[model samples]
Target: MTIAIAPIDPVGRAFFAGVVSGIDLRKPPTAAEVAAVHDGMDEFGVLVFHDQDIDDEQQLAFSRALGPLETATGDIAAPHERRVSMDLNDISNLDKNNKVVARDDRRRLFGLGNQLWHSDSSFKPVPAKYSILSARTIPPTGGNTEFADMRAAYDALDEATRREVHDLVCVHSQIFSRGILGFTDFTEEERAKWAPVRQRLVRRHPRTGRLSLYLSSHAGGIEGWPVPEARAFLRDLTEHATQRRFVYAHVWRPHDLVMWDNRVTMHRARRYDHTAVRDMRRTTLTNEVSSLDQAP
Candidate 1:
């Protein structure tokens, strides 16, 4: 079956967002269709595929068409045992009772960190290249996920700022970010598990050859700057890049699959009611190496 691509927002501003339709997820895409999706990925950093109606098995089959999937790790609980594949990261707030956890629940508090803008797996040695999140259930209002076009954010940077950051590197760590949100009581083992990784401040898209700002909440500090100064700079850059003009907030529908190029975008989950159930599964595609420059 043929696939269709339509821009979700203005081409000049939100160039990296689009809607893809007319393809069956129950079966894998043809070679031409795969290429079309890749082209769409390179051109538009995020593609929304609606009404996919795919289960974890179908989702894995489709994700394999794009690249190798990242294996899930950690002590996270599995809510939808049968429907949610073991390989997929469960991003839901529901407990075994199929109800949202208490407001002070550890899982609920931990997830609050997602409200900060970040790319998937930025803290890992080998970060994720792309992330596909499928909506199994959603609330009636709020909980919209917002994405920033980092390429556009980079282009909007003044010449002096661009020159200053062109050769810089930022040390990123989940510990640093989570600590900022008062989740600092992590064990020594957890701290070691999330040790800092250095990443280039600017990323050049391997396919499109376009440059994008790779800012993230995981940013600990600039490589050679003082703690206060580095944090100030990082905060300023994040504020600049996440301006409203560079963002698109997606209101999800059940069965919607939203795939995003983590290399060129930052996303954050908006706040929703603490008592409402919200279930989502994410499959992350791993890069060949820890750094984008060494990505396959």
Candidate 2:
């Protein structure tokens, strides 16, 4: 199918591609070529490609052109593969997995917020810069991904709200969120390893310094506010940020490549028939880990 590129939404300034077929992502992209992709991505926040029938090496080349891939770690990261693959299909049983549940598994359901509205990894001290996903095997129906334009959301926010959030700090706790999901059993060692998570409500882009939304479902609450009040506040802000009118829906097809700026957008996974296989390979760009009380 011919590659048809389009904006992320009717009102979204960013753009995304809709693939009738797919694109070849195996071969290495030249510097000039990749520059064009980055240029569009900076303006649009997301750029979708179709029909990526490439091998692991080709995928690595394309991803490296964007940024260095984050280290492959945890259950979601692919140890054997050249790049990482985030597998939402298999939730971690950290006990048998013999890993620290203090962070990974507890934050598991937090990813469920992807079904809601959020900036990717916004709760981190140094939030994620970008994300790349390639459709390895997509289910016949459903599991469509939707992305919201946060830059637009930021622009859309009332001036008063923006000023209020300008200096606010919110604590982002994976363990706290895990506790909400009912995983309260933690050894002292685990607790010690995890301090309370927190991040600034607003972040400046490392390069352009353009402001972007900086909060997530993993965000337990705004720092130092009543629990109920913080929850209400965060919920309302996210709700307004991702109204249906500001979204771009992508129906996955095999060999599709989608890239988005983590700093400027929020995305969610739509419900799909779990009985069917919907596999995808993802690489999160290594970014400075964001933290408030924690260290990078």
Candidate 3:
């Protein structure tokens, strides 16, 4: 089957996202289709596919066709308590029994970090390259996912600010982001497991060779800077980067599959009723090289 891609943006602005059609993700994609998807990803940081209707195995198969998948780790759920396979991240409010998680549940509180803008797996030594999320079920209202185009954000920055951030490296940790919401109830082992990793503040995308500001809520501090100063700087950059013009808010529909390049965008989950179920499954592609290793 042939694949078609159309810009998601309205008539005049620079398009950072696209809607893809004519390829079924439930079955294994052909090599040519996979290459087309890669080309689409390089051109558009986010790609939306409607009516995917794929299960975990199909999702994994399709994601593997694009690149190596990153195993689910560092989740608040204990290994035995997880409802989904290790290969997929269970992005939902449901518990193992398929019931809505308690409002005060530690797992739920820990997940609140997702509401903050971040590039998936930024806390890892080798961060994520892309994230493919499928909407199995969606809430009747709210729970929209917002994505910010970091490449555009970087381009919009003043020359002086760009020069200042060019060589900066920031330390990222899950502990730091969750702490912002006062959810620091981690065990010593958990703390050790989620230890901070350093990444370049600006990255040059390997495929397009375009530069993007690599900012994340997971980033706690910039290397060699005082805590307050680093945090203030990061907060300022985040505020500037997430201005309405730079973002796209995606209102999900059941069976929708959205794939985004984590290297060039930051995304956050929107607020929704905790009592209503919103089931999303994500398969992330691993970045073999760290942002720190890549030339800025």
Best by lDDT: 3
Q: Give the better candidate number (2 or 3) by lDDT.
A: 3
Give the 10-residue window scoring lowest on summed lDDT in candidate 1. Answer: 74-83
Cα RMSD to the true fold for all candidates: 2.4, 5.9, 0.8
Ranking by TM-score: 3, 1, 2
Question: Model 1, residue 57: what's the lDDT?
Answer: 84
What lDDT is obtained when candidate 1 is compared to the true structure? 0.83
Per-residue accuracy of model 1 over 122-146 as CA lDDT, tens digit each:
8877888889999988888889999
Question: Which scores better on lDDT, 1 or 2?
Answer: 1
Question: Candidate 3, residues 1-109: lDDT per residue as tens digits?
Answer: 6998888875643478889999999899999999999999998899999999999999999999998988899588998889999999999999999999999999999
Pull out the clashing pairs in model 1: none
Candidate 2, after superposition: displacement of residue 34 in Å? 1.9
Ranked by lDDT from best down, the candidates are 3, 1, 2
Q: What is the TM-score of each candidate against the true structure?
A: 0.93, 0.76, 0.98
Can you tell me which runs of candidate 3 are displaced by over 4 Å?
Answer: none
Candidate 3 weakest lDDT stretch, 10 residues: 7-16
Which regions of candidate 1 deviate over 4 angstroms?
Answer: 11-14, 74-86, 292-296
Predicted structure 3: lDDT: 0.93
